[model samples]
Target: MDQQFGEQIGNNLEVYMDYLFIKSVEEDHMLRDTVDTFQQLWKIIMKLNLRKCSFRMEEGKFLWVIVIKDGFKANPEKVQAISLIPPPISLKEVQKLKARLVAINRGRDVAQNPNDTEESIWCFLCEAQLYGAAEARKQFLEVGGDPRPVMRQAYNMFKDGGDPEKLVDAFSKGRESEYFYASLYAGLYYESQNEADKAKVHIVASCNSPYGQRSDDYMASLAKVHCMCRNWEL
Candidate 1:
């Protein structure tokens, strides 16, 4: 960023790898700086997808943590997912539970707006923890038995040597939403099996597809966030 805008606008930006954060206190300042930043990037032939771009957001997620006007806090959705699981009994389940717990770390201290009232739920999902949580949820559903299995079918397609490319081909033609979503979960299953190449292909396939790029759903950002957190190729 400094290489482009130099000191004039550099201090207001918080960039971590490819995640660029532009901060401004006043509304007018935000508007002016945002335009300036874009114009500068455009000169270099760099462009941002306006659909994926968020502006004037009072609250949102950054680095997997919830960001409010005051400061950052843990994501409640993840906490809810983890909390939903019953205590593990089997040794394997216990290990799985421990892995999930280890992923939640509330160590960062952002002083911009301190909140004494905030509950420290704390975390960002690593690729392992992300898929592990899915695995746990899958087990939770399969415990007694699923007479009609949606989650099982989704999780097993790759696990059982099903062709992901064929699934992508079929889903892509059926519905734009289905294609993106199916590919995302398919990537997770591949990742769990240590199939990085397959995982990357599926993960990339999950995003920027016809429907995903056009949809207003929050999951559209999931693939990018997943890649960023895991250092996977985007």
Candidate 2:
């Protein structure tokens, strides 16, 4: 709940709400008081500035739908709703719902069907979703699947001796090393141009990573880098 995050949520409530709803309630099958749930959904709808938006329960299922006054063609009505059978009660069922929603929101191709664009997109989206969540939740072990796209994003951000705060923000919580290291290198570029304090910050952050295994090899590599800068010893 950083101030910037609050502002971001305010700015892109639609996207964030979609994500939040998917992550917290819907996916998890966590039931809220019926009125409160609708109220929360209504809040998000308002933020989207939708002309016509509402939800309904039919045949013991919930249907959340949105209709922009004059947006797209066939589906000017972009609808996404959770078809709830009843109030969720079991933790196990909730977990399944969570997993399914995670797969859907992330565009993860859980089915492994290459011909399906939705599946591929879902898979990639799922990866991006997982990437963000893992960072926030400090779950680095889960981030080892594919580093290509993630690295690419980090690299672009690292260009031209990127901002330390921006790099750190993008690095995620427990998985700071990847971009933290990238930022350190980028910061070194600044250091070479006489930005010692900035370089020190990045290096120190990496040296104190909460995620990277503090293995001897990792520590030694960090020690060497620190030594190179004549900043810290051992």
Candidate 3:
């Protein structure tokens, strides 16, 4: 059926199992492209369950990820689920928590200390102090491995203090393009503080960054940042 429809609609339609994605490069041509694809579907005797279908949407969930005009996003429900989990108490619980974090992060390796014991993991989860700028900077410098995670932690520290400039400067020493999530966090922090112009600059940069263009998680964050900017305008 896909081959038959592909012959008719050309490159405008994509099919996976019973799912179909009708797309067009130009917004002006989208309606016509959808209509043409549907006509082809009808000719091939393909039935669509309209209740399960969406059309002309700016964004929607597909395969558990939010698909948007610019990119894909992590599902908020999944993020919330991870956040709601109780802190690990036992070794088994810590392992479970580690597994859950890995899954939520799309299989990205969860940070683990080489010398960590089960008790240490539990303490790290339950007794970790929220750092201030000085402590965050100290951690960022001392942990000279992946700067991205350190920058994120520092950005969050600044964000909690309503300091967007500090958040920006936290990652400015490195390539800004490499820390798209930090930039987006800074943008949101600025937006929360009613700094629309500053927020706009960071949000736009985040949306267009190489990481944003390539990673689904960043894309999802971009979708949220876009919505926040739109709402601010309204």
Candidate 4:
């Protein structure tokens, strides 16, 4: 079904399992693109459950999480459930609490840090590692502070097949001046995936960043990335 839809609509639509998302580069083309998408679906006799559908929404729930125009967020109901759980008194109850904490942290936006001090944040990062909190780890790396332990952890995670897309998404949410390390990591991930075009964009961005310009390691990595991309003008 996805193949058929892609054949018909090309880049104008995307299918994820049973869900379909229609996109257009220009606002004026949105209605036309949607109509074209529907026409292809109609030709295949694809029936959409309208109750499960929304259009032109700025924000909505998908896969049990809330997605806003800016980024993803935890579902309110899930947060409420976690909040309502009583304090743990037994081993089993402590395990349940741990599970709930993992779930809450998984859904949280990485950029929002409740901790203030470096020591506290490092403690949180260590706890995040213990719980496999990939989002937290990625965000901490992006925020850029004292880099020794955090960078080592990030390297370990990358070696263990951590998703690069999370770092890429974090890069998009960060300020330009704050994105040097995020861009570098994202570029490395894309490079590892054999995506030179995507890799070059981030690598070049990192090379131009103030932080990147000051770091010899970043400069070396940037040169290697440029060479890989066959961009000799660097």
Identify the candidate with maximal TM-score. 1
Q: Estimate every model's Cα lDDT from 0 to 1.
A: 0.57, 0.38, 0.54, 0.56
lDDT of 4: 0.56
Task: Write down the TM-score of every candidate.
Answer: 0.38, 0.30, 0.35, 0.35
lDDT of 4 by residue, 1-234 (tens): 545674533356544346566656667888988898888878888899999888887677654467665656778988898879899898557755775565455423322331122333333334443454445444332222234433433354453456655665655556553466566666655655557787678777777776566666644464456545565333
**Number of colliding residue pairs in model 4:** 0
Q: Which ten residues in a row have the lowest lDDT in candidate 3?
A: 107-116
Compute the lDDT of residue 47 as modeled in candidate 3.
85
Model 2 alpha-carbon drift over 4 Å, by segment: 1-146, 157-161, 174-176, 179-183, 211-213, 216-224
* TM-score of structure candidate 4: 0.35
Worst 10 residues of 1 by lDDT: 113-122
lDDT of 1 at 189: 62
Q: Candidate 3, residues 1-234: lDDT per residue as tens digits?
A: 435654532366544345566767789989888888878877778788979998888887654466677756788998899889998898657756774554344311111121112222222222222322333223221111233553445434442354656665666566645466566766655554457688778776667766666667744564455756476431
Q: Which ten residues in a row have the lowest lDDT in candidate 4?
A: 107-116
lDDT pick, better of 2 and 3: 3
Clash count in backbone of candidate 2? 9
Candidate no. 2 TM-score: 0.30
